[model samples]
Target chain A: MARPARRGGGYWVYLIPSLVLFLVVIVVPFAMNVTTSFTRWSGVGTPTWVGLGNYAKLLRDERFWASFQHNVGLIVAMAVVPTIIGLVLAAALFDYIGRRFGTRTASALRAAYYLPQVLPVAVAGVVWGWMLHPSYGAVNQIFGLKVNWLGDSDIALATVMAVMVWFQLGYPVVIFMAGLQRADPALHEAAEIDGASWWRRFWHITIPQIRPEIFVVLLTCTIAALKVFGPIFVLTRGGPGSATMVPSYFSYLNFFQKADVGYGSAIATVLALIIVVVTFLFLRLQERDS
Target chain B: MRTLRAPGGPPGRWAVLAALVVLAVVMLFPFVIVTLNAIKSPAEYSSGGPLSLPQGVYLDGIVEFWQRVDFGRKLWNSFLISGTVALAAVVLSVLNAYAIGIGRVRGRLWILVFFLVANTLPQEALVYPLYYLAKQAGLYDSTLAVIVIFTVIQAAFGTYLLSAVLGQFPREILEAAALDGAGRWRTLWRIVVPISRPTLSVLVIFFFIWTWNEFFLPLIFLISNDNQTVPVALGVLQGDKMMDATMSSASALLGIVPAVAFFLIFQRTLTRGITVGAVK
Candidate 1:
């Protein structure tokens, strides 16, 4: 049944200010970035049209492909790996720890896990940099080892991925905890009464019950992984060689550092398109599932 | 509460508790280590173990970090930018949320969908064009440029949140106000804002923390040394060949202290904001 409508035709006026700024700052520039991607231009002078040239270069560019490879690695490292780890941690907190102790303790523990999410990436980078320093860093000396954490090309990306995983762990934990709240207790009880072990019940009942939250975590964290720039900017500056360069960093380097605005915009547009497409696909999948 | 049984009574429960404690320690230990090293001299840092206490209350790391990083200026700039964005963003969101939510404006559903998409456009996507625009406007190096960009970003989220809050406002109250000849703006300023204080506080707190921590836009826009926010300013401390592990440790501590303290203080509200925003 439809509710009675409020009396107003001028209500659109209230939305004007937010809409204007949003369009100018976000929508219009987004359109400009799309057009700029097609042209050849440095940051200065005037733009010259060279349709498809940048995209052609982008496709053939080894660094571009390598950056995508790193992004895929990041997907596994930051999004996929963390989701699995966070789920188990969250399940333990919800099913075992919190159930045994109390929610107060469980939520407190949740906050502790959430510490990394609160700090800015720059700050987290500094802390990690201090810890991962090659010579006198705490992590190396503590283990009585020497490793170039942010330098050596072979392992710097892996190191950065590890940090992103750490930063992302808490978000899913909290979201999953809350998702668990809405789960039906009956299913868990039924599984338990059938003499299932804790693992069995969690596998059959808990994961299935909170499937939507898993998707939520996956989609959000994956987008975050794609846009990861801050920590890289601080910790490694895309590193000793181009080891940790993701598309986001690649774009910034091309734009500000390399002064190839067209190429930079192309990289950014490609990355942004990927994020939007993946997000759209996930949302559609979610809609279909429900 | 007992729908799901604990597998075993005490032993199993204790193991789970121990595991959780370990997880918490793993999460929090980095902060503790950083704090311990912040006050140590570079010599103490190198010679002693990572966990060793400073021999003498040496504070050179923090002192050097303070003098070198333009610490006070960064804090002030962060404060000003975050405050301005929070205030302005909240007002814009409140007004927009009011029209679409309480006023039940036509095409309200479309407006909400528009913002949902707008919110996801990786803000980095716009940094270039914004850079170009700011340069043209002579706002390239100004804090105003950062403020203007961030306000729009935060305002998008704020609209969604405050809209939900406004939608819950009792109709009878608004009807009474309308009957009293109060106009829309008047009813809003007089009634809706006061009653929606809790949600507005949530929006403001979230915006304040987000803007203060915002790095990319400010990093690109605010190029001047003194104009950068806390995160971007502190970012320069890392990877400097001359800068030691001690200064990095100290800067890390300084960078996190404010956000962490704010979190602890308003944790109840902040936690609510997270869960609400998530489950929505």
Candidate 2:
């Protein structure tokens, strides 16, 4: 069932353009960034090598630690919470709604959920920022409360998290719903005939059926949470006094705002390392499971 | 398939439907509020609060925002950049996938993995260096720089997906093409590409949307007012203390229009593409 083997050396020509572009855009710039992390530079003068100095400083930097801590919160908001809720919503839409209400209702609901995902994150930030504004904001106007959504340091991160949940909820719903389409209806019908509850069937059949998608969703969303910047930039700017700062925005501030390019590079390098490790761990777990 | 309802059908099912409707409304609440507010004058908003219906349609805020941001120019920049990146990245992906998938070039697995990792590398890791280099190359604040950068980044994902799809290409077709004396380039254009058009179209659409939504790189590189993309322009304006609530809502509405249009137009393809990309 195999095709004839082709001569391979000449094929390298096809790869040359892509390879060159990769080197220029990703490889070279990434290498330079890592190298820059080892030096003290203000984006102007020659870089002075100061091996591990930026990393050591990061260990003692309260802001750096706080930013990573916020990333943990974001992980919960963007990945963990969304996956749980998405699983249930997807099952309901696929199994319950599609059966009773029809596929039209199910898809319409899915599209409504997916609306935020299509919008640029910055635009989403604007929408939420306006809605949550303390004075003239819609939430306050509707609920008749004076709670400051983005101003108070205490409530700000939670507000941001809630907005992120809104922004991220759609992704897992869409993916899990798609994965559920591949599940055999007979399995569910057989379970139902035996008096297995909806909850039971969902646990036994649905979860296991969509495990690959669950892994994919969690991995991608977690990575997105870690690298989240646009929302922070537009909504909170990592403050009312550094309350909602995340690593990506923190690094950006260092690079552009504060002119500490070396430290920024170090922060970015660490973030890149963490993301790679997380991805590998997920792949390894997926491999072990299958 | 037999239709099976819950034991308590009407009450339980209706309750579930009601809850889902509520959730969907909650998800859409912001857009609803923004749209309501965007059409109200400041006087009307302050008097009626955000919950009140607008007395009359007000286009002044949206008009003001458009003029202030030169939004037409921003839209053109976004369209041009995303359009170019989509076309260029698809071409790059096809070429690379050809070598690795159909050609089965040496070390293809390693090359695929390299692309996978490259795709995962955060923009932060490449941003500053790219910034400096762009500056050095006298391409600072140029749309060309952004177009080039995203072309490579998006192609990484495209190449990864396309390689797998092309690898499973029924070798009988390639063998047949060869039997007829079709060269590599000839076979690729006349046979391989046409067969793979569906996947390539998916790649083009995904690349365009992804590039359209990109914030970090464009935010850094496209610094000038005239060069900024839609998201960046709207974002930068968000920090301005002078922007009134009506104006901001107007801005948000403007930003959302094109994205929602794209989503509605390409909803089917986007969903199918997402599933294929993720599961594969």
Candidate 3:
């Protein structure tokens, strides 16, 4: 029932405008950044070739290292906590709400859960910063706790991580809920017939079914945690003496504020390399594991 | 078998529902606070917890806040930036995705993968470099320059998503159109566009919301008040009037109003975007 081959060159005509625009805007700029990273340019004058000087400086730079460490901390915290909490929340919701409510309510609830996602990160960061304000803010006032969220190095990173989690939880929860909805109900029914406990059924049936969702959630989240910026900017400005500085924030400060455009470009180039390599390795590892 | 009266079920369900309601309320409390506080007098805001409801709904605070922040002009700027960016991005992405999705281009998979890799790069890393290039081109502090970058950076991911959608679409439809002497442009304009409206609309909403709320881009690119978007404008307002809850809240409200309107308009599609086969 295969149709005969047809001849047409219309695709090329339609493709030209988009290709030119993307190449000039994205591809060219990206290549330029890579090239600029090896030079000593201060954003106003001619760029001088420095032959890996910027990369070497980045290697020994304590501030850059501090930012990397902060990102590592955030990635670990965000990756593990949100995935687990989101999964648990989905499980409880599916077990309880899925069986009782009609399809419309379930979807409405899902939308409610995802409201945070529509929020601009800047607004979320600002609102959260205000909420965690030390004196008359709701978080402090509600719990009668007087801790400064963005101050005091000990708690600054954690506070940022908490806000990140709050802002991020909705996406993963909805993802997990969708995964749960797609899982085979018969497996649960069989477990029910066998008189398995709710916890037991979840462990045996639900967890294994949604492994792919779990993996995707973890990967996307780890990458997002590494790239986090708006909250850091709005809340702490990578402050309390670099307590909350992440690689993105550090790179931004260096390139723009510090006027070390070459070094900043180099840091950014390295970050891009890290993301590509890490994601490649992760996909490879997942393929092998499966 | 368990029923509503089962030993550990009915009451437990109620408890869970109650907890969820509480969570929802807590989640929404900030909006309530920002709304009420923005409507209160400056003196009232300074005197009590920001979470406290005002004694009366006062327009004076909102009026003063609006004037101080230049809310109307900032909102118009934000609308212009975000609207243009989303529109241009959708056009570019739809075209790019169409090329790769339906065209006989070689290395299509590689192109898609390159876009994916580019999309994952930390945005902060590119901020300074882009700024440098813009300044070099004498486009600094210009609205068009920011819109160009926003549209471009966003187009990479937009292409990635739209291409994924296009790939899932059956090519037979396009092939059949071609068999009937319909050209690629005609086929895409007549056939592909109609089928892909759902995905395209979702993309539009996503881009609009993100572009509207974006701060880092505007912060670096827009150094002039005339170029500032709502979010950047609000940040400046906060800096200018430190600790003025009414002013800050009013700005926040203004920043969010457009987003809320967009969300309400496309609520169903937006929800579906987050859930429907999203993990893939």
Candidate 4:
């Protein structure tokens, strides 16, 4: 009796369900979106091919430029600031707390930090919206001030950024702390024995050991910053004069609110392109670093 | 294993611990305040201000918001959608990973990379077209539409992670399964899936939570009040500016309850899963 071949054509049969679903759900819709970008449509009738009209409109659209600019600031709040703070927090929790006090105490603190991450972003917005309401808000009540946190344009963006930092701080801390577990304790012991300062050991051993986790956190968080929508939708709706407008919310407004489907698709396409480029660049940097 | 002692003495360590405790309290302040105010009567809230403690517990805000939104229906819709997506996505992921990881199918690397890229494709890029397509298919305003979309989207990540995991699966076990005359499907169900159950469970939990928290696509697809998920219902209500402060706090508290419950229940698995995902 001959053994039947098991590894070739037979395996593709298992992939059939996933492949079909992928095509319908992701590939076809994404392709249609890109194709729709070159047309003018109100999303009801046939879309007329406008060539580069939408893209041209986007180029001069001040809102479009402002949205991208807001995204850059969000990158700092959601990614850069959080990563820095998270690194310090994770090191303290892992090295200082976990080692000296107990892992239980460290973990309990980690859970507290992670609590915010468990809420839906929209709910988080609601919570903050209530707390940051111009008149009767908790922040105002606590501080005895009358400042409008989400109403003033100059201050609105910063308010959103601060909230984002609160929302995002836990992620990097969790990831880096997990990564720390795999670090060779002997190296830390040796460094301590040699009288290496805590900061120096953190700079040398802790950071390098978890570089992969750091890269992963930064990449994911940056992408998340770019794609953020729910909080914007709930908190301000990209409002107070588009002060907190982001590319995703901008596209959403065009699609649903304005009924400018073609322009919306174009904005989304640009965002997708930027994300892909950023991801590629990050991966390349990672590969080179390794 | 023995705990390694830091160079800092007990006093310095206590200071660091104090700082961390303060940070943790600040991190949890929103939840603390929300819980505090959610039970306060609007009259009390107005008179005493946001910082003041309630003289009496108030269930009216919570009850009224729940009734106003028919929040039970929304919860069921979210549960139905996220639960279905989680199970279906896991099945889809296992099937795809079995092909690419175990079978080592032709051009597997390219296929894996495609899934990886697909995982990162912003939903904004896909949302409008999906909206259009869903409307065309007569699936608009339906939980099924949200369920289907999330199943595929979540599985992209699941397949990417699982492929890497299943790729390193023990070849001898598979060879033995084959030698025992188990067909491909049988081997998958009996051998591969059983062994990969932990990873699959992790994927299921993640997909469920992610789908439960989804807003944009669900907001688009589930336009009807009957079909809205918890996030969508609360979000639309918030947008409409119809809810009072106590009502909004009550709504926020309700929204936080399920998620926090899931987090507590799966804290260990989640912590372990995050490491697995990151290290892999």
- The most accurate candidate by lDDT is 2
lDDT of each: 0.85, 0.93, 0.76, 0.89
Candidate 2 runs further than 4 Å off: A1-6, B1-8
Superior candidate under lDDT, 1 versus 2: 2
- Candidate 1 residues B7-43, lDDT tens each? 4575757777887899799889889888888878878
Q: On lDDT, who's better, 3 or 4?
A: 4
lDDT of 4 by residue, A262-287 (tens): 99999999999999999999989999
**Minimal lDDT window, size 10, model 4 chain A:** A1-10
Q: Which model scores highest in TM-score?
A: 2
Task: List the DockQ of the predictions in order.
Answer: 0.55, 0.65, 0.46, 0.69
lDDT of 2 by residue, B1-280 (tens): 3344445466778999999999999999898889999999999998998878999899999999999999999999999999999999999999999999989999999999999999999999999999999999999999999999999999999999999999999989988888888888899999999999999998899999999999989999998999999999998888467888898889999989999999889988899998998899
- Clashes in model 3: which pairs? none
lDDT of 3 by residue, A1-290 (tens): 22342432445565677567666666776787888889998887799999899999988989889998998878866777878877777887787666654455556665666666677777777677666766656677667788887788999998888777767777777888888888998899888888998889878888888887877788888887777777788888898899998878787887778887788788888888888787887777767767
Candidate RMSDs in order: 2.9, 2.0, 3.1, 1.8
For model 2, how does the per-residue alpha-carbon lDDT over A133-167 read when each residue is reduced to its tens digit? 78778899899999999999999999999999999
Badly placed stretches (over 4 Å) of model 3 are A1-10, A101-112, A143-145, A285-290, B1-10, B46-48, B236-241
Q: Write the per-residue lDDT of candidate 1 for residues A141-230, one digit (tens) a residue.
A: 888989998999999998988888888889888888888888988888787778899888888888888889888889988888888888
Clashing pairs in 4: none
* TM-score for chain B in model 2: 0.97
Top candidate by DockQ: 4
Better of 2 and 4 by TM-score: 2
